[model samples]
Target: MSRFLFVVPPLAGHVNAAGAVARALLARGHDVAWVGPESALRRLLGDGVTVYPTGMRPYGGQRDRGARALRSLWEGFVLPFARFTRPAVARAVAAYRPDVVAVDQHALAGALVATAAGLPWASLAPQSMELTEPLRALPRVDAWIRANLAAMWCEAGLPAEEYVDPRFSPHLVLGFTTPALTGPAPFPPHYALVGPALDHDRPDEPDFPWAALDPRRRLVLVTMGTLAEDVARDFYPRLVAALAPLGDRVQAVIAAAPHTVPDPPPHVLVVPRAPVLELLPRVGAVICHAGLNTVCEALAYGIPLVMAPIKHDQPVTAAQVVAAGAGVRVRFGRSRPAELRAALTEVLDSPPYRAAAARVAESFAAAGGAAAAAIHLERLATS
Candidate 1:
């Protein structure tokens, strides 16, 4: 059996999807392991999983909207974290001796190491990021990103003549979305547009108050993901204000930092965390920051959305949702209560939104998900 090593970032959403695909590999009797932050892997993948320690440095402190956010993301977080973890990833490779490496799009070290070693690797890329080509209009920005990738290649001591963009693997690229959401793509033959990896093999989270849900009320789930908690401080109160006035028809369950929504009305439930996967089935709608993981998860359940995209590929992903008719978007920080309310009402009450979501869900099923990702990885390994 081929050995597969998954190299991912410390971020939970990245790990969650990787964990699903890793488990799928294991089920087929291949050996699978991970190289990333031990604490995060243990928290998400459980203590039993093998994780090579790559000392964690948190994401960049600068969280905002637009081009500035993109700069901070690469310079502050991606490139820095890549340099920090390169040694550990190389060490993990030497020790595990994997036949194939699976690398997240942001985990540049994996591609660098595998390529330098003359081993095949597959990019577990986000549809919102590489597949969407969000930076095509910003030619300078695109060149800036490529130059950094080239620098990282040079730092790995690989020859400049043999350079390739580490964020994308030449062997295979597994995207976490389908053309149904991304529109038709210009990607090559090796781009595998597997749907959201819904196997989500993590252990069950049982703490959510299922009884607190009102059977008669149309339920909405609001989550900005863990990374967006601090940035969401002001957004929550405005969100609360928007949803508060709509209590006659809707109640919201917000997964947020403590006290973000102070004195939340009985119709709203604000918690330190919520069992999102478990809660998705019961909810009719979602209000999110348009993080790809959240968007895919909400869509997997065929739930419509109201998106507020803050940074990076989120805005692009939000646009895709709007184009697909699965959701509507609002300004992240500047959205007034009336606007937020209107967007929420549009998705929650509109039949077209739910119908569109279901259509996307059907496409996702047809594309296959974790199983398809595993099949691609296996072929890359065996080929």
Candidate 2:
């Protein structure tokens, strides 16, 4: 049997996606081991997989821009942590001696460890990292390059000369985006579009207050994902204020997150978390942060959206929604109550948004991400 080690950052989205791949690998009679933070241990355990805890929780904070987040990751996590864990990783490699490693793109420790061990490794991209023409044309090109260079130098102890080589490419680069959305890039031979792997076996069916939900009023589900956990803090109040005008005509369900539940607006139902798929079929529209998993989840249900993209790859992901005519993007600085209300109204009122969402839903159905990824990994392991 092929022995594989999958390393992931502590982030839920990363762990969730990696877990899907691990499960697929295990089902194919391969031995799978995950080396990362204890946060992922529970889920991996539930899947009957082995875990090697790294005692490192990745820094999870929202930056104003994607570039800033990347910079922070390099400085805060990679530089210090990779050096600290080098010995531990070395020992793990010697003990387990995995044949291959699949790791999240954000985590450099995995890359370093795998390279040190001389094992084949795959870099997994859970968000949009593919450099686009517009991004490349941005005026602050020099500043961006400087930051990236500085990051690389600090994290990997690499000078400019080292990065020029094609040896930097991982054995495989698995992209988690629908081929329909991302146009082709001239990637390496091993590059594979694995699409969004949202294989969450939702345990603890949270008692969704369906009886409390107003059947007469049109429902709208709002969320900003688990990382941006406390929705009640700042954004939730503003959203409630904006959507309050809809009143009895529209029933808003805000997953305010369990720990910090906000006092609900008159027309809104505040819940910790809802079975997104089960809830989406009854809802007219969704308002969310432009998280990749959330975006894909909404598309899977063919739910039109008003995307309030906060940070990271969100702006770009939101742009895709607008470009596809599937949803409206409520930009960072411009998400006032009135603007949100208008955007939500537009998505609900128009047939085009619904039609666009339906088209993408069809595309996703055709792609069959989970099944495809399972088949691919099975072949890779067996071969």
Best by TM-score: 1
TM-score (C-alpha, index-matched) for candidate 2? 0.84
* TM-scores for all predictions: 0.97, 0.84
Give the runs in model 1 whose Cα sits over 4 Å from its true position: 204-206
Write down the RMSD of all candidates, one decimal each. 1.3, 3.7
- Which parts of model 2 are misplaced by more than 4 Å? 43-47, 57-70, 78-86, 130-169, 184-188, 203-207, 229-232, 257-262
Number of backbone collisions per candidate: 0, 0
lDDT of 1 by residue, 1-383 (tens): 99999999977788888888998898999999999988878888888888889988766686756887887888888899889999999999999999999999889999999988889999998548667784886677788988988988999999999998887788999999999999987889998999899763476343777888998889999998777877888998888889888887787899887677777888998887888888888899999989888999999889999999888888889999999999999999899999999998888889999999999999899988998899999999999
